[model samples]
Target: MTKTARQLQEEGLLYDVFEQELTDIKDRTYGLVSELSRASYFDTEYVMSLVRKIVAKIGQDSYIVPPFRCDYGDHVFIGNNTYINYNCCFLDSAKVTIGDYVYMGPNCNIFTPCHPIHHELRKEKVTEYALPVTVGSHSWIGGDVVITPGVTIGENCVIGAGSVVTKDIPDNSIAVGNPCKVIRQVNDKDREYINSLILDDETKNSKYKQEHGYVYSAKDEAIFNIVKDTVHYVEILNKLSNSEIQRRRDFLRTFVAKLDEGAMINSPFYMEFANHLEMGVNSFINYDCIMLNNAMVKLGDNVLVGPKVSFYTAMHPIDAKQREQWLVYAKPITVEDNVWIGGSATILGGVTIGKNAIVGAGAVVTKDVEPNTIVVGNPARVLRKITAEDSKKYQEELAKQKDINKSEFDKMMAGQWYNAMDYSMLKLRQENNKKTEAYSRITINTLSYKDRMAKAIVKEFGENANIIPPFTCDYGCNVKVGNNTVINHSGVFLDTNEINIGKHALIGPKSGLYGAIHPFDVEARNEGIEKAKTINIGDGAWLGGKVTVVPGVSIGKHSVIGAGSVVTKDIPDDVVAVGNPCRVIRKITEDDKINPIRKK
Candidate 1:
C-alpha cells in the first residue's frame, strides 16, 4: 500500500514539497496569515481571536505581533504568557512547540524544513524532510535568531540575538554565536548580581527606596497609586495619532519628571512610574519601546532609541520562595549623551551605558558599558572601540558634497535635513512611481521588456543584472545595480539616498534596504523634514531572504548576511554575519570549499 505525502512527512521521511495535500495546507495557511496581517495593529483582542484559528493551540495571554509568517500553522503550539514580536516566521513543517513565559524577539525564524544537500537530488524532484523544533519555558530567544531543524532548547535558557541554533541547548544555559554554543550556565551568581545592586540601609533611608536600588513592595499603596495614574497617561499616549504631536508632548510633560525640548517619544510607548523617567534634549524614542521604570530611567542628550528597545528597571528575587513572597527590587538605568540603542536591545536594571556607545539590535546588556564602545551579543560584550578614524572617514565623505546652491534634493543627498514634501521632490517621486508601476505590469515572460523597464528605472543598470517583478523603491534614479547581480522577488529599496550594489551580488527575496531617516525633533518630523544616508553592497556579496539593511550601512565584499538579519552596523569584508544587530560570526576561509555531500 502506498502512503500519502502527508503520511510520509509525518513519518519524517523525504516527500514531494509540491504534493497536492501539502500545497493545499500551505495555501490555506497563507490566506489566514494575510488576514491576520490585515487586522488593525491596535486591536489586540481581535488579533488573538484570529491567531486561534491559525495555530493549533495558543494558551491564555500568548500574543503574537502582526506581520507574522508561518508554514503549516496547524503544527505550531504556543504556551501561556508567551510574547512573540514583529516579523517572526515559523516554518512549522513539523510540530513547533513554544513553552510558557518565552519571549521571542523580532525577525526570529524557526525553520523545520531540511532539503537534500546534493543539488542534483534537489533539482530532480523538490523533495524535503522536516523535524520538530521546541523552545522550552522561561527562556528568552533574542531577536533575529534562526533555530534550525530538530533543535530543542531547554528551560530557562538565553539564546542570544543573531545566533544560529544548530544543536540542542542545555537547561539554564546562556548560548550565543552562529552555530550557537553554550557560554555559561545561569547560576546563583546571576541572582547575587541583582541583589548586590541593593543599597545599604543608610542610602535607602536618605533616598526614595524604589529609585535607589532598594527592595520595595510593588503592592504598596503609594506605589500602586503612582502606577495607576501612569497607566492612565500611557493609555492616552498610545491612543494618540502621529499627527497629535503637540498634544502627545503636553501629556508627556504633565506626567514625566523632565521632558526636555526636542525630545520625542513615538506612540505605543509603555512605561511604569512615568514620573521617574527623564529625557534630555533631542532624544528620540521609536515606536513600541517599553520602560519598566520602577526606578529612575534617564536618557541624556541626542540619544537615539530604536523600536522595541526595552529599559528594565524592575527585578524580582531569584529565589522561588522570595519571589512568591512578592519581594521586588528596582535599580536606575542611565544612557549618557549621544548614545544609540538599536532595536530590540534590552537594557537591564542598574546599567549605565556611557556616552557615544552603541548597543546593537537584540543585544541584552547586563552591565555598565564604557564610553566610545560598540557592544553586541546576548550578554553584550564590547565589539570595538570608536576611533578617530571613524570621525575622519565620515567627515571626508561629507566633504565630497558639491558646494553649489543646494536644493532640498541636494541637501537630502548630502545627508542633511531637508523638506521631503517639497514640490520638486514630490514630482520626482510621482515620475518614479509611474516607472515602477509600468515595470510591475510587465510579465516575467517578456525578458526584453522587463530588462528595458529595469534599466529605465535605475541610475545605472549593469550587464546581466536581473530584478524580479513586484520590486519596490522610493526613488529609482538613486539606485545603481552592478554586473551579473540578481535581486529576488518583493525587494523594497527606499532610495531616498544612494543605494550602490556591486558586481556579482545575490539579493534574496523579501529583502529591504531602507535609507530614509526622520528628524529626532518632533516639530521637524511633523513638518515633513527628513534626511537620508547611503547604503552600499560590495562586490560578490550575498544577502539572504527577509534581510533588512538600515540606513548608512555597508556590506563588504564577499560577505554573506544570513536570512532574517536586521543589519544596523557595517560588516567588514569576507565574513559571515547574522542576527538583529547583525554581527560577524566568523571570517570566510578556503576550507569552506569542502562540501559535505562530496565527502559522503
Candidate 2:
C-alpha cells in the first residue's frame, strides 16, 4: 500500500523520492558526458544515457532531443530523445524535467528558485524557497531562451530563443519573442520532414525505436505510458499548530538546513563569498562577481555571466504608508542555461531569463526576458534576431579568446579566491551579532503606534526577514503569509480583512498591495462604508518594483507583474502582466521563443 501523508510526514520521507531521483540523474549525467566526449561522433548509447538521466531527474521519462549541448552531472532530466541543440541550460534548483523529443537551440536556460527581496534579512542570513520547472514533450525551445521557477513548458511546441519564460507554456504550435507566444502550428508535414532527417537509415531508425520504445512511423501509447510515470516534488506541510510567524521561521530553518551542505561556486574574479554558489557542469561564472546569495541562487551548464555582474536577489521597503506589513512577497531572480548575460547587467526580482538569449550591456532588466533574441537598453527591448551567424561568431570569438587569454587568466585567478560556503558563514555570524544587539529591545518612538503595527507585521513574516515601513491598514488579523517571503521597506499592504500570501512570492521595493478599497462614490469613500473582500497572492508570483495591486484583486498562480506598473484589475493564471492598469500584456509563452515579434 502507498504511504499515508501522515506517515510520510513523520519520516520526512516526502522529499525522499525526489532526492533519490536527483541522485540518479547526477550519476547518469556524469557518466554519459564522460563517455560521449570520447566518441568519434554522436554516441547513441551515451546520448540515451544522458536523456535517461534527465528523465529520471524530473521523475518522468520519454523525452525528445533537440540538437543541443548536453553536459553536467547534477539534477537534470529530459524526455525521449527531445531534440536539443547547441547552448541549452537546465540549472536544476531542485529538478528540471523535459518531455519527449523537445527541440531547442543555442543559449537556453531553465532556472528554478531564487532569493528573498530584502537586503537586511539577507545580510542577517535566512533560508529561501525553490520552485521546480517542467517542460512538456515535443516542445521546441528556441535559441537564447530562459525558463523561470515553477514554470511548465507544454508539448509539441516551438519557442524562439532570446525569450524569457516566466510562466506555464501550453501544448502545440509555435511561440517566439522576449515573452514567447504561440503563433502557428507544427503541422504533420513539418513533423514528417524533421523525422525523415533522423530516420533516413534502418540502423538509425531501429536504434531510435528501441530506445524510445516505439517506431517513429506511429505514435504509441506504451511509449506514452513510460513517459507519464516521471517523478515530481511537492512541498510537504507539517500539521503542528503554530502562529504564522513561527511556521515561517520553522520552514526557513528547515530549508536552510538542507542547503548547508554542498558549496557550489567557481569564479575567475574577486569573490565576496564562494560557499553559496550552486553551479552545474560546463558552467562558467566570470570575473568580478558579487552575490549576497544568502537566499538561494542558481546557475546551469554552459551559462556565461559576464564581468562585474551584480545578482541582488534581495531588497527592502521603507515608507510610512507601508511599514512592516505582511502580504507574502519576495523577489527572486533566475537565469536559465546556455544563456549569455552581458557585462554590468542587473537582473531584478523573480525574473526568469530564458535559454540562449543575450542580455546587452548595462541593461537594467526589471522584468522577465524571453529566449533566442538580443535584448538591449534600459527596461531591455528586443533589438534584433539571433541567427546561426551570431552563434558561430560568438563561439569562435570565445574559443579564440580562450586560447589567447587562458594563461594570463589562470595567473590572475590564482590569488585570493573564495568559495560558496564563505558567504554562509559570514551571514551566520552577522545574524548572530544582530541577535546579541537586540537584548535591550530597542524601540522607535514618535512612531510608537507604528511599532505596534510593526510587531503585528513581523508576525506575518519569517525571522531575519525585513519589513519596510510607511503604510497603514484597517485590521492585521486578516493577513497571512508563508515562510521566507519579503515585503520591501516602503511598500504598503492594507489588509482590512483577509489577505493570504503563499511562499517565495517576490514583491519589490516601493510596491503597494492594497487589499481594501472604496467605490468611486465620494460619500461611500469618505464614510469608510465600503464593502471589503479578500486578496489572495498565490505561491511564486513575482510582483516587480513599484507596482501597485489594487483592492479585492486576486493575482493568479505564478504570474509575473512588471515593474512600475499600476495594477488596477485582476490578473489570471500563468501570465506576464505589465504596464499601466496592468493589461494582460502576454500569456506566459511555453516554447521559449525569442524575438517572435519583429520590432520594426
Candidate 3:
C-alpha cells in the first residue's frame, strides 16, 4: 500500500529512507578521500598515472568520485588544487570547466546537457547541446549548489548554502542562495598580507601576524572572519590545468573567424572590448554577440548601434505615449561606461544611458538611463542601488576564460553537416511558388500655434513656447511645455528659449505659436539670455480644447485647469487655473473626479 503522509511522518519512514541512502553515499565518499590522503607519494603517483589515462579517455580532470557517474567526458575540464566532496555528480554532455583552487560541497551537481521538455517527445530521446559551464579559480561552492549550463562563476568567490546558480557570477564576491546574489566584495588586504609573508621569507605565521596590526575596520573584520571560517570547510571539487595559448588561439581562429561581418549578423557569443570604447562603441551592423568594454563603458563610452538588439543603454520609458515610441526609437541609442544592459533588452534613439547603471532586458528604453542604478521590466523601473564591486567582479569572471585551449578542444568538436535548402528555391524548382501582398497607410501632420492664436476669442497670454498645442509641440525646438497637461487640436509651437510653462495645464487646438519671448528688460533680452531659464511647466495642469500655452512658466507635477483655457501664469501643480489669468477656483482631487457635485 502507498504510504499516507501522516503515517510516514509519525513512523519517520521518509527520514529513515533518506538518512540510510545518504549515509551509504557519505561512507563511500569518505573512503575515497581517506584513500587519496593516506597514499604514499609513489602510490599517489601511480593513482594519478591511472587518473591521467582515464582523464585522457574522459577528458582532463575527470574522475568518478565513487557515487557520482555520467555518460560522457568529451566536454569537461577540471583545474588543479580542486576537490569534489561526497555525493557530487555531473551531467556534462555539454562542456564543463572547473578552475584551480576550487571546492564543491556534498550533493552538488553540475548539469550541462539539455533535452526537449515536450511530453510527446518523452519517448524519443532527443537532445541539444548548450554552452559550457565554467567555474573560475579560487572559488568555494557550498553544499547543495546546482550549477546550470552556460553559467560562468568568477574567481575567488564564495557561494552560500543551497544556492542555485542561474546567471553568471562575477569574481571576488560573497554570493548567496537561490538565483544567487552578490552580497559582499573581496578586498586585497588578505592577499597583500599573504604575499608579504613570502616576501619577508617568514616560516612562522605567528611572526607575520605579530608584525601586521589589525588595520581593517569593523565591517572588514567581520568579512575577514567569515572568509577565514570557510577556508577549510571547502572539500568537494573537480580540477584541470590552465589552457595553453595555442588552444586559445585555435579556438578564436575557428570560432571568431567564422562570424559574419558588416551590417547584418546572427551569432551568440560575448565579445570583450578594449579600454578606449567604453563611453560608446558603434555596432558593426550586426547582433550576434555582446561586445563587452566594461572598463570604458563604466566611464562613459559612446556606442553607436543599428537595429535588432541594437540599443541597450537604459531602462524603458515611463510615460505611456513615450513608451510606445520605443518600437520606432529603440534604435541607435548611446551610453556611457559603467552601464549594464540586462538580457533580451531594447533601447531607443537620442537618449543617453547614464554611467554606472543597469538596464534589464525585455525592457523598452525610451528615456535616459540614470547613473548607478538597477532598473527592470518592459518600461524599466529603478528598484535598488549599485556599486563598483559589481563592475570588479564582472571584469574578473570575463578574464577567467582567457586561457582555454581552443584548438585541441575544437578539433574534437568539428563535424560535417548541411542545413535544409531555402523554401523559395525549393518552391521554384517544384513550380509551386506563390506570392501575396498587402497595403497600409502612413499618416503625418504639422501645425502652427501663432496662426491659430490670432483667431481665438480670449487673449492676453504669455508669448512663450509652451503655448504650442500638445501634438504640435513635437517639431518645436524651442517650444516649452507645462506639467500635468491635456492638449487638443494640433498647433505649431515656435520655441526660442526662456519659454516656461506652468503645471496642471489644459490647451486648445489649432493654436499658432511664435514663442521667441524676449526678456521684459529690453537691453538684456536683446543679448538673448544665452543661457536663459528653460521653459518651465508646472504640474497638474489642464488645457481647454483649441487653447494655446506660452512658455517661460514653472509648472508643477500635479494640478488641473479647465479645457480651452489660455494659460499665462506660472501655474503650480494641483490648482484650478482658468480663463485669461487662469484664476484658481478649487483644488482638484480623486474625490472630485468621482463626485463632482459633492466637491463643488
Worst 10 residues of 2 by lDDT: 230-239
Model 3: residues with Cα > 4 Å off, grouped in runs? 1-47, 56-68, 126-128, 189-600
Which model scores highest in TM-score? 1
Compared with the true structure, the alpha-carbon lDDT of candidate 3 equals: 0.38
Q: After best superposition, candidate 2 residue 105: deviation in angstroms?
A: 2.1
- TM-score-better candidate, 2 vs 3: 2
lDDT against the true structure, each candidate: 0.75, 0.45, 0.38
Q: Tens-digit lDDT track for model 2 on 286-328?
A: 3334443323356654455644355644322211011112101
**How far out, in Å, is residue 245 in model 1?**
4.6
* Candidate 2 Cα errors over 4 Å, as ranges: 1-75, 184-600
Residue 592 in candidate 3 has what lDDT? 41
Instruction: Assess candidate 2 and give its lDDT.
Output: 0.45
- Residue 242 in model 3: lDDT: 12
Error of 3 at 79 (Å): 2.4
On the 0 to 100 scale, the lDDT of residue 167 in model 3 is 77
